[model samples]
Target chain A: MTRILPALAVAVTLSSFGSFTASADPLPSWVSSGTKDQIVEFVTAVTTPDSTDYVTPADRIAVFDNDGTLWAEQPVYFQFIFAMDRLAELAKQDPSILTTPTLQAAAKGDLETVLQGGHNALIEVVNASHSGISVEAFQAAVADWLDTARHPETNLPYDQMTYQPMVELLRYLRDEGFQTYIVSGGGLHFMRVFAEEAYGIPPEQILGTYANTTYEQVDGVPTVIKAPGIAFIDDKGGKPINIERTIGKRPILAGGNSDGDFAMMEWTSAGEGPRLGVLIHHTDAAREWAYDRESPIGKLVDGLDKGPGMGWVIVDMAQDWSRIYTGAN
Target chain B: MTRILPALAVAVTLSSFGSFTASADPLPSWVSSGTKDQIVEFVTAVTTPDSTDYVTPADRIAVFDNDGTLWAEQPVYFQFIFAMDRLAELAKQDPSILTTPTLQAAAKGDLETVLQGGHNALIEVVNASHSGISVEAFQAAVADWLDTARHPETNLPYDQMTYQPMVELLRYLRDEGFQTYIVSGGGLHFMRVFAEEAYGIPPEQILGTYANTTYEQVDGVPTVIKAPGIAFIDDKGGKPINIERTIGKRPILAGGNSDGDFAMMEWTSAGEGPRLGVLIHHTDAAREWAYDRESPIGKLVDGLDKGPGMGWVIVDMAQDWSRIYTGAN
Candidate 1:
């Protein structure tokens, strides 16, 4: 921990240099474009003390979707990849665990076959791979997997696949007294393992689809074991509902990349205050994946069609982002 | 808000003066005794730079039960009172809403009858009164009720019934970089309404028993409406389960007054670190209600029987508190 401080110090110094410059940019990875300008303007308006649009520190809540908005979700949602990987490993140990068609498909890495089986099949795969273990054991498994696994295409560690500009935006918002949260359709426990380290958002702030967990005394020690069922799938309308349920406040700003996040951004826009809705458009095939409207993961029809009319800033990833990931372009 | 600032300024000045004194106490409402010393020592050890128990700011989580622990919950849990009052109000407008015996009993202020009906009946009354309302509308109703409603015995506003020492402890813990959260069996929306003002805890930090709410476009705006059913009862084993589900980390400190909080404290204590469990034993009948084991609400037999053995500090309200409520002896 002490040894890593020097590297962190150098990074901070480099970031601080951008802040000290005449034309300073807190989000240095974001291009000097309309998208960046809109984000900066919204933050400035809300944070400026004398501005009519000014919001208090406590009310300065911002919610961002995890998969596509904050990080890359190209061929599939990364959590699904984790589930498939986990299932494959489990199947190798005990082939009997892949009892169902979907579980077997997932174990065989047949993404198309599993997707064709629909929501129930997806849930079966997820539950089989994710549940029936203590939360601590599951967390340990996720941590271990993340440490060794890399993105098939990027060859980068899965956690390192996070968007640089969005990471900077999160830091910038926190600096401006905004409470940043991840309202995702991803697995809660899986995201929690890396959210703090990768995104600088704490465990409590990351709200996502969670499994039904039971509290029991396992070997006389209190343990929360993940049960084999989805308690809630935080997608589409579920995003806003979970946001209100957890945060109990309408976020002033919402950032997302798909139809799943449409309601959240809509809710944020409906609040009678200075609100901003940012939709990250995956239009960068050179640096990142560019499938949108008809994408298997992160489908963006509603967001692409109705977002602009709602005064939401649609981020053209290829145009707006100068750097896709940290230390990479 | 401007009118209240001068009073707030004076309170801050007065509180600051204590820090400047030779033997000043941050928790002046608490007696300078073992209980107070223990709390201070635990915080100090975790905060000190070179201490073996030094916890980072992000990991310094503290959870407290809201009902009997942070505030007074004597005659009945305040949320039950709120539910009863709400039912009565609704029944006045439309008597048909009181379809069940439980609802009718609650509407008529028959506390004994309502209590006799048990958990399902209690839930029925709550569901009847609390459901079919938007989150914003429900919050407004709770805020209005809190403003007008007073404790039957003390005749003070329900929000003001919060214990002074506990409030100070919350502030002190926050000052020492601990993120304080309320984990209680109270209505989530009800507690969220006044939590910030009453206890300095933000809405997001307050976790409680929640109803199943549905999100819909009421008119043209996205609205979260409370539906009729208890989604969770955050008591006993559920406390630790919800804590892990929401926070994803075991708290360093757990504070409560009843057996409902036993699992939470046990979970906190079981974590590998310097942890503290504080049981607020309501032993002062003169200043506050003192029923424990035989009490309908906030029964504390397990806490009394096993807390000390678990290294938990038992706070005797009669002896430990110099002041019970703020601005009252």
Candidate 2:
């Protein structure tokens, strides 16, 4: 574990042109108050060696839940949107899957109908579209799709649509020697395939939902074939357990934006040592979209009610964040 | 990210009984002549920044096969031995299992009979014992068992019975900025529970076979409940895919001592740059048993045949290494 912070030069960017213009500073729009001060103070107190809240580098683990917290999850969860597109493409050949309730729902672009039976039905469709292919072929296919896939509403390429502040936050925390991990309700394999290219997070460092895959020797060459089973579900309550199971060390910092992340933030706040939990409230109605409590996507009203008791930091997106997306680079 | 290499004093035999032992050079005993020379040469060549073969520190990845490369897997693999012990202890409650053909065969302790069906049956016993348990409970159980579990022939605690030379080798390479990973055929969850305590390697760096597991909300607590299915088989050809899939870099250094590891070394050697492959040939019949080709456990005939042609360094246990087990305190 070597710190190369001093050796590497800090990159300074002054507003580059793209889908969205870069500002002089990322937090221009964020309203400052005790809320912002608390966050900055917390990070300073824990990270500084002299502070009472100073934590050793080993204990300085931070985890972030993706989707709504880091990026736009409108129209539907981005992955579900991708899966739906994939399902529609596959529906051309397998017309019979449309007869099945789950596949029929997905093909009909009905979220309730598709998620009706849940696990069994979703697995059937995922297996139909995602499995029985070589890993290389799968990776290339995903790469190609990701290169061209644009969000239906935002018209932003999915990758570019990431929250700029969170990306900067990830880099800033890493600069302070905190190992960052993404503990999401997303597919581990899919996230892993893009983590390095998209976020600089490596596969081994990324923990999420998974399926059992096998490696086989065929025609004197080795190939890994995806198996037909669910291995781990890294959503909701499973977040903390997966973090424990995979990383061993409990994170001192955790961030999220939904009830699905409530357990994670709860676990992080209750940890014995110094901890930080940040919740991104969907209050930005103009740029992106906003919904909570009654909405299906990223509901977090309970989280806000329960957060203060647990020492979680709630960031009203409208006031606390200056920027929304990173835009295309 | 502090590079504590200077502070990480190497372990040596303590001069008397002081808590702080005088540090020996973290370097190994093998004189830079044959195998050791080849290894050091390859590592140096690849890591030299100005050289044509120079690889970045990120690319200076090294993978090792655990079973034969790091420890003994003679009469039976240690984990299987642990499984056998677990099964026998459980047999008291279900005595009929002891008399049943499968359980009787298992209890008799003849590994051939115990694994009569194949790897799937082996996993069947393992899953029941390892899954649905608290992470702490599983870890404590492993630590407790390792404290007392001894090889039948040597009667030494399996933990202390690890290959001392290889242990030193790991430190030596790590000191030189090589990130080492243990690629093994053992159960992933099982190995993960103990790898850090036994080997000083982080859980994130350990790759192995796994069974299916799921996340569950139990009494409002998040738990990864083990499911009844095979996930990934991190053995043979699977080793390379797992390495590439997990590590995302071609190793500059690789080591193993079995046909199961041949694919891993081949994958390493196939890269178009300076790289080293080492096969640990157990040749000390006096200190321990030795077998290859015909042996079910730790077979190395294929690795031996292809090693020289592939520019791999084969280290004969009795010849290249001066010490067998240092029994590091």
Candidate 3:
């Protein structure tokens, strides 16, 4: 706790430096061309007190999709990795899980078999790995997994796999008085574990897919037990619905990668104001994995085709981002 | 929006004056010698940088139950009034509603008949009045009702029925860098209509019971259609459950006034380190309605009995408050 002060002081100093140079380069990781200008122009217009597009600080909500938009989700969604890891650990504890067909398929990295189970199979995997445990216990498990988990391709800690340009954009938005939130398709509990540490966004500001939880007293201790059922799915149409129910306001700015975020972008752009819709087009095969319409996971075909018509900025990751991963170019 | 600047300046000036006189009176509406002291002490210890109980600004989450804790709930919860009002209005437009026995009873102010219909009946009424409408339409309806509706007993607007002391406490907490959230059993849309204007808390910070909603393109226009079903109930055990699901952290400070709040307080207090639980006991029959321990609505028996043992401050409304309603004694 004491060490946190010096780190905070350094962050404050860095932030002050960023603010001073905001007009010149708030998003240093972003190229000084293309969508960068649009982002800066939109942010400036909304933040200027006398500008017609100026929005109040309270209403300056900006939502970002976690997976491909903020971090690399190619190969597979990070939460799926977490789920698979949990299955392996469980198999070690109770060898019976290794024999279970679906669990066995998951353990062998046979994603095709797992997906064949369809939505129900996916829910089964999520429940088996994520639920029937106390929330505190789940959080601890996630924290421990995150501390050690690394991306198979990069061998970097999963948190370090976050996009540098998007990280800068989040910081710039916050500095410009916008409340940034992670409206993700990933599990809420999983996102909460590292949201603050990785993204500098608090857990409360992160809304994601969730499971039903029951409150019970266990030996005079109050505990929230995560149940084996989906409470909400924050994808496609569900994104906009969950945002409205949880945040109670439409975001002024929304960014996502896949077609799943199409409704969210539409809902945001439909608002009667100066709204910005950003779609991250993953086209950087050299720096990162490249997938679009043909990909099974995080398909971006619909959003890409609709981007121009909807006035959404399609960020060409290969062109717009000067840097990809946090510490890599 | 321009007018807000001067008003904010005035509030800043007033707050400075209050700070200088903080030792004498920080909460003028609250009695000088009561739970007020405990609240101030807890806030001071947590906000102080060097104190062992120090909490970062980001972690200073303070949850408040809306109905009985922050505002009056006697003569029935205010939302019930809104629901009944909506029923009457709908009955005027469509005479068919008159044939619905429960709605007819609600329109006639026959709460006995309405309650006899049980939880399912209550859900039906909520969906009838709140759902099957666009989110924007429902918000407008709530706004219109709040603009004209008055408490049957006090003859004051429902928003004005809020406790002056609690208002002060909210302001005080905000001044000390605590983010305040309204975790209520009332409808989320209903609460959002007036939460910002009445409490200075933004709609984004307000969480409440909500109905299922669907995102649809109504005539090619993106709209969220409120669905006919209870999505979440934010009361009793539900309070803690929603808090965890939404906020993803245990509140350090929690205030409520019913048996429904018992689990919320327990969950909040169960967290490690400095915590404060406050139960607003309705004991002021003269200044405000007084019915606890056996009241049908906002029952306080379990909470009141266990408050002292849990180190929760049970606020006796008669003795603890110098003023009850905002701008009234």
By summed lDDT, the worst window of 10 consecutive residues in model 1 chain B runs over B17-26
**Runs in model 3 with CA error above 4 Å?**
A1-24, A98-100, B1-24, B118-120
Each model's TM-score? 0.93, 0.79, 0.93
lDDT of 3 by residue, A276-321 (tens): 9999999999999889998877888888887778789989988998
Q: Is the docking of candidate 3 incorrect, acceptable, medium or high quality?
A: high
Candidates ranked by DockQ, best first? Answer: 3, 1, 2
lDDT of 2 by residue, A54-148 (tens): 99887788999988877778866677766776778778877775667777778767777766665566666666566666566666666777788
How many residue-pair clashes does candidate 1 contain? 0
lDDT (Cα, tens digit) per residue for candidate 3, span B216-295: 98988999998888888898999999999989889999999998888899899998999999899999988898888778
Interface RMSD of each: 0.9, 3.7, 0.7
Q: What 10-residue stretch in candidate 3 chain A is worst by lDDT?
A: A91-100
The residue-by-residue lDDT of candidate 1 on A24-116, one tens digit each, is 678999889988999999999999999999999999999999998888886778888889999999889999998888888899999899989
Off by over 4 Å in 1: A1-23, B1-23
